[model samples]
Target: MTNFNGFQKLIAIANEYGIICYATPEECLVASLPGYDDFLLAFSWSGAFEGEPPEHELIAISIQDITKEVTVAAWQIPTYLFGNVLRQAQMLVTAHQDFVLRTNNP
Candidate 1:
């Protein structure tokens, strides 16, 4: 079970990657990133359920108006790897945020 602090770290990471992360009652985390012109990378994740457990997966979608394109990538990570990914993402976000901050500051 992840604590609030951990979740906050995840959000920070997403922000750094120029992605937006939102939480829904049904979905644990939803991440979205705009790519190129209209293309986008959207991903959602659900840790575990009450009765039946679901696998941890990542999905990437590409939107191109009428010609819609989609790609999916799913994988299961061990409990140990979960923290590492989360931390890495957080580090990326922190670095991105720092870069932007420095660039904007005179």
Candidate 2:
């Protein structure tokens, strides 16, 4: 698969959990979800494919909470774990949203 196809596959996996990601001009995958938008979640992969990706290659998933001006989450894992990591990321974003909402309301 070409790099675009690889990114598209990743986008599809992220969409399964309602996270919308698109390729930026810089060739980075960025999330533009509601609660997760401010976090600027960006994914990076080097030579990852949908079928039998290189074991040595790692995908970096990171969330930088721009609202709080800090990075709240970051993870580097093999391509095979992409789906699992995306699920965890969705949970993390939900938790952060809840925390911010409560803090603001209280």
Candidate 3:
């Protein structure tokens, strides 16, 4: 079912932002942001009836800080809202990377 072109397109979009994603044997999509190892995005889909396949998906983002031993989770997100959420996540990661670069250079 994940062979759908749309799925591939989503993977491509993630890759464009330096996010690596793969499908698990159970069909869940797991993504990781390069250079920001603390954040993870996991996408899962349901609502398949009679093998008709699901038209929408759910997303969950997990953020962990090992130094502080804290974990933040955002889950049960609909795909319709994923675009904005993804963009925000990307911006946050980019900002963090920029901060790291500046601090290391100074």
Candidate 4:
């Protein structure tokens, strides 16, 4: 995983690559729906598939300082590395959501 300096850098990368990180629970859940988008939600919705994934999208290292693993869209992760596609979907949702929060409120 890339040692990011901060969320701003991640946001920069996301913006440059057209990486549409879904930042909403509904978006996350919606992206995870297999038949809904043909499983495209497992990845970034905008099709920018290059670069080291933003930390929010990294399954190995999810949110820290939390008492328990947080659920993203449709699966549990941040504590285990074996989460499946569902977890990936949730991760995107969580990451994208976080991105929006940071960008909007920063």
Candidate 5:
């Protein structure tokens, strides 16, 4: 089940952004865009039912800095929505990096 190519690519994105990147047997990857103080993304593999494998789930988590409390936002994206999430992350991270670069340069 974990052999899915898309899963590997998603995990690669997590690694690229230096998120909490350790793959467990439960088959999950977690990530956050670099520029934000309170944001998170996670992918989890679900067990198959009947003969068809279950679609993986992508969710957003919110965490508090002081209290260390976690709250998962209301989102459960299937494979179809994966690209949108990935694209959003890329855009955000890139913009923030550019901002930091300019700030440092000046």
Candidate 6:
């Protein structure tokens, strides 16, 4: 089974920042603004459903509502190194201005 620890950390960070994190069979989606495509972040996992080693690639989709902007960012991780990518993702989400704390975990 794909390791979920990394995903858990991502969720924790999202919650701490008041972002909504949703996990599905294919990937995880994080969003800070409701009904706004510009504030949505999607993390697509390589080995999400199959029982195999975790794939080290993340597809970050950023939508810019103003000016009709859309950006696609791709980061590749070496084998057995997903934590760094997770941290980077968290940092990216936290940099947004509309962030809020969504969890009470200390």
Top model by lDDT, which number?
2
Please report, in order, the local distance difference test score of every candidate based on alpha carbons: 0.42, 0.71, 0.56, 0.37, 0.51, 0.47
Q: What TM-score, to 2 decimals, does candidate 2 have?
A: 0.58
Q: What overall lDDT, based on C-alpha atoms, would model 4 receive against the true structure?
A: 0.37
TM-scores for every predicted model? 0.35, 0.58, 0.44, 0.26, 0.41, 0.37
Candidate 6 to truth, TM: 0.37
Candidate 5 per-residue C-alpha lDDT over 1-106 given as tens digits, one digit per residue, 9 for 90 to 100: 3567756865665555456555656666655544554545556544323654334443432222222344323245554455466556545545655775798999
lDDT of 1 by residue, 50-95 (tens): 5643322222222222123433223434222343443343444445
Q: What are the clashing pairs of model 1?
A: none
Which scores higher on lDDT, 3 or 4? 3
Best-first order by TM-score: 2, 3, 5, 6, 1, 4
Please give the ranking of all candidate structures by lDDT, highest first, separated by commas.
Answer: 2, 3, 5, 6, 1, 4
Q: lDDT per residue, candidate 6, 30-83, as tens digits?
A: 453444445445543433335544443343334223323433334544334533
Worst 10 residues of 5 by lDDT: 59-68
What is the C-alpha lDDT profile of model 3 across 5-95, one tens digit per residue? Answer: 6566556555665566787786656776445566666555433336442435544554443344544444555455555656666576566
Error of 5 at 69 (Å): 1.6
- Residue pairs with colliding backbones in model 3 are none
In angstroms, the error of model 2 at 2 is: 10
lDDT of 2 by residue, 1-106 (tens): 2487666766776677566778777776788545455767787765545676465457778877877887667888876666576567668887877987999999
Name the regions of candidate 6 deviating beyond 4 angstroms.
Answer: 32-39, 44-61, 64-106
Superposed model 5: Cα runs more than 4 Å off: 1-22, 47-67, 86-106
